[model samples]
Target chain A: MGDARRALALVRKDLLTERRSKAAFNAMAFFAAMVLFIFSFALGPDAPGMAAGSGQTLLQYLWPGLLWVAIFFTGILALSRSFQVEMESGGMEALRLYPGDKKAIYAGKLAANLIILGAMELILIPVSAILYNIDLIDKLPALLGVVALGSLGFAAVGTFYAALTANLRARDVMLPVLLFPVLVPVIVAAVKATTLVVRGDLMGELWTWIRILGLIDLVLLTVCTLTFEFAIEE
Target chain B: MNHRAQAAGSDTGRRVVVEAREVSKRYARNWALKAVDLRVEGGELVSLLGPNGSGKSTLLRVLTGVTRPTYGSVELFGAPPKTSNGKRQHLGVLPPQSYLYGELTALENLNFAAVMYGLKSHDDELVEALAHVGLEQAADRQVRTFSSGMRKRLALARATLHDPELVLLDEPYGALDVEGIGWVDAFVGELREAGKTLVIATHEIGRALALCDRAVSLRGGRVVYDGPTSSYEGAVSGATDSVRMEAKR
Candidate 1:
């Protein structure tokens, strides 16, 4: 119970800190939007499928890619910025000295990253819906489930890599190097699961992918939680 | 001739909170601590003094259960240091580096640490700890903006916030200014007055001499002198003078 409270306090600290600065969220959201805009222009207004295809089918195909791309790139942006606030402010070591369970620290960071990525996804979802002409109202719950599962996998790996690279001399370059390799399986599973849902396939393929994602999240989270103490220790 | 022997001979009569028997640690090709032994009782402030690379930090790490000794054993609060939750719970550690988050404000850092120690209603405690370390006004400020003195004070606040029975500080006063050092001295004095045992590893001979009840001087990972702080200093000075005279030859 005390551990839970401490974890919540750590989460609250990250939220409050981000609320004050707005730098992390802004950078992530802008980067995500830029990616979407580039994709939109590259696939131009008069491109192969834009004129002849049924808007629903077009959206169903494009929505999954758009959502996952936004999330993946934006996640990288946000996770890279995970310890920036702490490092810039010179407070990373101070947090470690606290007598709380190191797990709480990991959870707190995961929570903050989830919140930032979730917010970015929320914005990207609507923008992608309109731009790609996808009708998502009927499949809201399923889409949400996919997003939640995928985000968990991202946050689980992201938090660990952030701590691992926090002290390295080339943290900016090191984070993606370490994170992308480990996250490849997660991204593949998430993309496949999201595509099935976005197409409204209803072929029951979603559950298998969801289960795989769930297992991946669970394994990564457990490993990261146990190993985080060593990564953060001085 | 060894402090370990004297401590063992003395342990039968009194309560020993921490006891290290023939503890040694080796990292790869280098031996960080070679057959070191120490015993610290409750309510005693033992200053561990040594030159750089004398294994002071390594010894503290072993004692705190953070590092396993390659040879020998350590018991804390009458139980093997690793097995006893009560022993581990009673210990407070302040490492040489600031173990804190600079992104969070001073109050947030203290609050987070206090909660981890399972303290209920730490608002007043946090405020009091900050005030004790002269960081009350800057409590809402991020630690990154703090000067070295303020950062050290914040570190001290975090270490003592839990009110643990045993406090292990590694160079706790290294970065403090004169005034900041006085503040730390007073804080340690207060903790001592309240019967909390402290083991501080530092090179500041004067501060250790003035603040500690007992001092142990380490040379090549061995305790060469362990006794009352006053006698320990004279012995160190005499040894230094001898080495200097020998150099003339």
Candidate 2:
């Protein structure tokens, strides 16, 4: 079979299983909403007095930080569960036995995590804007673009680590510990880019941050694709 | 490394399908398999019998390319097994535990394997496989709801759903009942009749001796006995009687 076809089949299998079980979706979606709500409370009802005539409140300043924090935690939850299914059922060995470029398996898993996280972000973005009381309609496209790139970075590394840690008894705790350090570049670039895009500065620092995200994603995707065969093998 | 033709219903003109030369798998300080040499002819039901931790599973893993032998060469279909997906596609493997997802239905589990094997249409094969395993009525039921015996049946169905030429099963009768064991014997018979090769790693020496064309016994990662199943007692001497009785029980 062609690599692309096998990748598609794997993705289809994952999505169909997720749809039927709703295990990851239910837990991830609920956790994402709770994170947003908690941030809303933590940010406080009264807008803190930051800068007069600066046209931004403390909540606005914290938007990028809080949003990425939410995504980081939620992404870990979703990615961990993605491979947990395979590990718990011993399906990883079976998947490794599939005939094709093994990279296709990694590609399929990365795409599935991206889709699940992306769908959650779609819901979280609007609700987050409402809770944070920020008007993001104008910058929505740019913000989403940055988010997509940053998410690709997250999925790339997260998918690799998820497979690495799947067999560990401490996988749930180990995943964040191993993943967060590596995700520093993505989180930094995403926060900086999202802040600028949300602040209506699309042509200056935003592009630089976007470029950084793209570069990180490119590097991580290549590295993960090259190493996933080893990660899943015995 | 000669090639073998494995078309169904043709077992004559025996040819080699699996070849292992001085295959040794070492882990840390322990050797799992030490200088083991084995060759399986096409269309043979070869049972690997051994006690706990006797390297049956390790050898099976080596043959299936799930693990690389530490110090020797192994091949399936006349080539090193590790690098070729095409050869793996023509092979089917079942470990002791079921690998099927509990959330997926019986049909869905088979469908996943069919898709992985790049089967264009499995509707008919799916039905036949399910029926062959006597899981037709439970085809739409989630695997989690099935009993252990049922799950084993479903796993067998899923493994063979792709019509693989060689089947490698490790402890295939682990969770089976009396009827399930009978079913497995019948299934192996059918496979032998169809000219498909099989390697079954099992602890049940009596059943394996009764069903397999040949038997290979391992002790402490080394082959202790390899010959016709009928003369296994003579090959291993007095120790075989106790192990065989224990296995029968």
Candidate 3:
């Protein structure tokens, strides 16, 4: 089979698996929502407390970090799960033996993570806005664009490291440690662009942040594509 | 594709499907396989038999290109096994684990394997394959709900979906019931009729010797015996020290 077709088949299979079992999807979605709820609760659920205690409402300054924090933890949960299913009964080895470019395997996995994590953000983004009383609907398109770009970078690096640690004993703990340091640039870019879009400042330095996110996406995708075959081989 | 390229010599007109010479596979601490030489001809059904930790699965992995040997070499068809996508185009392997997606329905699992095996549309073939394994009624059922025997049957259907020429079966009967064993026997019988090559790794020495043309036994990563299957009884029973002792004679 051609590379594209093979990759599509794998994507279809993985998505179908998630659709049927809802294992990763349910867990990540609940986890994302819980993180948001906890954030709202910890910050006292209103602007008055922040204003009285710190001279500024918590959501006004912390929403961007909180949003990305929710996405980051949720993405880590989903990323760690990407290869865990395949580790069930040697499913990873079977994929490794599939005909054609091994990069297709990585592509399918990265795409699936992007789609799943992106969908999670779709819910979390709006909910995050309401909880923080931030009106983000006006910048929805730009915000989504930044989210997609950032997810691309995060998922690419996350997918690669997820595969790397799939067989290890402490992968749950190791994935975040291995992934977060490498993802500092994407996180910073995403947080910066998100803050800019939330503040309705797309014209000035927002494009630069988006460009940086895109560059991180491109670089991680390229590196992951080139190195996946070697990383997965026995 | 170079997959169909002809090797120089033939095994008396039979195609040499697998060739391994001085193949030694080592891990950090110990050898998994050591100085083992093996050859399998086209249309031959061979049994690789040994006790636990005797490298049966390791050898199967090396042959199917799942694991690379630390030293020596292996060739599948006319080329190295490393060319898995090409050389293993017609290769089917059932590793010790079923290697299936438990979350997927039986039909979906077969469809995934079929696509990977390069069959463009396997809907009809998958139905027929599932029926062959007596899993037609369970086609829409998720594999996690199925019994071990049913899973094995599903694995069998997936492995043979593309009609592979050479099949490597690792513990094909591990979780099988009597009926499951019978189903495997019938499948093997059919493969024999079609003249497909098969390498089976099993601890069921009697059954394997009865079905296979030749028996190759291993102990401690070394070949203990390589001969016609008929002599398996004597070779296994006569030796007092080690199975390797009788094969040396």
True contacts kept of each: 0.38, 0.72, 0.67
Ranking by lDDT: 2, 3, 1
DockQ metric, candidate 3: 0.69
- Model 3, B1-249: lDDT tens digits are 111112222256888888888889998888889877888899989899889988888998888777899989998897887764676678888777888888888998988887776677657778888998899999999898999999888888877787889988999989898988888988888988988999999998878988898888777787767777886666655432554553365
Candidate 2 residues A112-149, lDDT tens each?
A: 99999998899888888987788988888898999999
lDDT agreement of model 1 with the native: 0.79
Model 3 CAPRI quality = medium
- Candidate 2 predicts chain B with a TM-score of 0.88
Which candidate, 1 or 3, has the higher DockQ?
Answer: 3
Model 3 scores a TM of: 0.93
RMSD of 3: 4.6
- Cα-based TM-score, every candidate: 0.84, 0.92, 0.93
Pick by DockQ: 1 or 2, better one: 2
Kindly indicate the candidate among 1 and 3 with the higher TM-score.
3
Clashing pairs in 3: none
Instruction: In candidate 2, list every pair of residues with a backbone clash.
Output: none
What is each predicted model's overall lDDT from 0 to 1? 0.79, 0.84, 0.83
Error of 1 at B243 (Å): 11
Candidate 2 local lDDT, B1-249, one digit each (tens): 101111122435688788888889998898889778788888888899888988999999898888899988988988888766688878988888899888888888888788777776557779788999999999899998999899888888878877889999889889788998888889888888888999999988888998898888877777767767887766666555544554465
CAPRI docking class of candidate 1: acceptable
